[model samples]
Target: MSSATKYTRGHATFNVISKAILAGFATACLLPFILMIIGSFTDNTTVLVNGYSLFPEKWSLAAYELIFKYPKQVIDAYKVTIFVTTVGTAIALTITTISGYALSRPTFRSRNRIALYLYFPSLFGGGLIPWYIMMTQVLKLSDSIWALIIPSLVSTYNIFLVRNFIRTSVPLELFESAKIDGAGELRTFGQIILPLITPVTATVGLFIALGYWNDWFLSNLFITTSSKYSLQYYLYNMLNSSKALQELKAISGDISIEIDLPSETAKLAMAVVATGPIIMLYPFVQRYFVRGLVIGSVKG
Candidate 1:
């Protein structure tokens, strides 16, 4: 009968309803991935006949077996991708944050001009032929791992996101206070600014990591040696090879070619392998990602 009791009941009902809705949404999001995983394990013939399903009539490891047929190559690709993603993300995050902090500081008189310089390239680019020449002929980065790392190390969009987040979420007075305490720019940034911008940094780091992880074009363009291929590129090559084999079989009309390439299942398997590590990484940064997006999106 009391107002407090009614309020409590209403709040409890809202919580239950909200939780149920979120649960349903989460399940819906996960369903496709779950089916893909299951389909990867299902017999290729069964999958071809039945399409993808939660419950497959027949089970098989043909796809995984084919993928791991050259375990060394797969392992090497994994190593390359992991190293690139880790090192590239760290370096990119450092550069972006530092650039953003510099831009955000009102005392930096040339920030506007510098920002214009950074933003201009993003708007217009010299054609691919020139870019290729610059990388291969000018930089001499061909067949080198650095080729992959250097090209995408800094993103203009990410830099601006961090700059905006710092300007809006962080107070200018804090910088002045640090200066008064005899803190050098480096010391002040490390101790004060870095801590306040954790959410934005994590978000930017995640974006950089994903970009590095998913990048296949860089490897295709710059890398000639098979050993240096990143995971995405390696998988892309494998898929191409599989399709080639299928095409050859179709042309030959030879039922005895014995080319049992699990193309569809192999695709599913590749997705699982390539995405598994990055998917695991999401939960650790999920909270920061959401908070950063909110804080960064608010117009200063």
Candidate 2:
């Protein structure tokens, strides 16, 4: 065979192998979400009894009916979650951006020390007991929306991401030119840096939004009242109350239990409601996020 033909065949084989590897990785990443979506619709009794099934053999809308029946709880949860996600993302992004920009400035002497002060918390969260006591006894944050907001406002990882992105991407000349034109740091940051960093900002903001939206741990611990539960916490109760029901049944054995628990279908509906907007909006944001990474190449 000719050398040219052999090289062409090798290139074709390499391309095919690369595509197959990428496809496999994509499938691995997507399979869990697909299972969750499918499981939400599958008969829970069947799933509990016979592992997860790809398709629902016995379908029912009972779960959705139950959620709709007590729509007040779900609606309230949505309100709280939306408020938290929006406000939390806004506050987090603002702080992260400002801090990151300040830290990225080469002349800042306290940047490293301040970064350590912020970053150390992520490595070891004060154990729940001490943290809880601090928030509740010391700070009096229990039973308030501030419980969620305050704890999550400053993420060490976010600060680092913003700082690195700013350092690697944002142009120094732009800041210099702005300063030479007599623009103060705050004005330059507000008007110039912020506009240019929208891509990274959007990326970080979306991450914060998702974190707040999907958070159940904070609500579960901090909120004792029904009215204060976020969507994830409320949905969690609706989705997984089977264990509690089982315990109740075991306690009072030999009696027919008829507590209306959320059904598999309703779980699917809830999942859809929870993630629908994010999935819809991600494509738009992703476009810019990609551009941000691409545009912000190495800085000297």
Candidate 3:
């Protein structure tokens, strides 16, 4: 690395090279998603010809039409997903924020021990069979929406993020002032602490929301009812069924049907539909997320 003064040749060269490199890297990252969007509109034959291009020679909505054919089912799945993400995120944030704050406080007697205990799960976990038994048999959460909400209500990693944010960014003097002024723990947390940690709270809240929104494994493991399927799980089932039927048809040598199913494009279209809103959510929280990451990265 060269240490150069302002506007020198080396500095100017590095700046130009850095800008081009970043631009290319960003484009590389976005290329697949761009291709996916284009591919969703490209029919099977056109895809065969163009093979995932910046611009497709032909375009069609047959895939989207196929997907929306069961609009009621899709809508119901959307409602279930929306409800889960909203309710689960709210509850998760409350639990994670409160626990993180408590753990972050120097005055808390067992803060270090509790933080370690909370972090243990992220390193190691009980086996899947035992976890399943606990949820289904012990807790009686099988086939219930609570199964989705409760199991992932708080994450060890997220708690640590919150803890670090509070310990580093929030001043202890403020808490002492609140204590001297006769503010209870709950009141201090709600009114003063909550307002101060808005950046970190938003960051953690976004993480929880994304986790809830994209969850499908919990549905696969616990949920059996079609009516209760989240959007991701519903799409997973659709894609799996389509692939299974295609495989069965190939094995059976059945070529009798005249109508072609939008197999590949439909899968891509479903991906687009499921994740579209989440992509839109990133911009709203990006500033807070950057601040939280920076603050949380600092050691206490």
Better of 1 and 3 by TM-score: 3
Best by TM-score: 3
* Tens-place lDDT digits, model 2, residues 163-237: 887787787898889989999989988998998877778778877787898899999889988888988887787
- Model 1, 1-300: lDDT tens digits are 455655677888997999999999999999988988998898888878988889999999998897889678789899999899999999999999999989999999999999999999878989789989999999999999999899888898889998998888787789889999999988988999999988788888887888899999999999989989999998788778778877888999876664556468888888788878878877886776687677666866
Candidate 3 residue-wise lDDT, 113-221, digit = tens: 9988888877888978998999999999999999989988978878888888888878889999999999998898899999988878888888788889999999999
lDDT of each: 0.87, 0.79, 0.85
TM-score for each predicted model, relative to the true structure: 0.83, 0.80, 0.87
In model 1, residue pairs whose N, Cα or C atoms come closer than 3 Å (at least 3 residues apart or on different chains), thus clashing, are none
Predicted structure with the largest lDDT when compared to the true one: 1
Tell me which residue pairs clash in candidate 2: 63-263, 64-266
Candidate 1 structure, TM-score to reference: 0.83
Error of 2 at 180 (Å): 2.9
Model 1 C-alpha lDDT versus the unseen true structure: 0.87
Q: What does the lDDT read for residue 224 in candidate 1?
A: 86
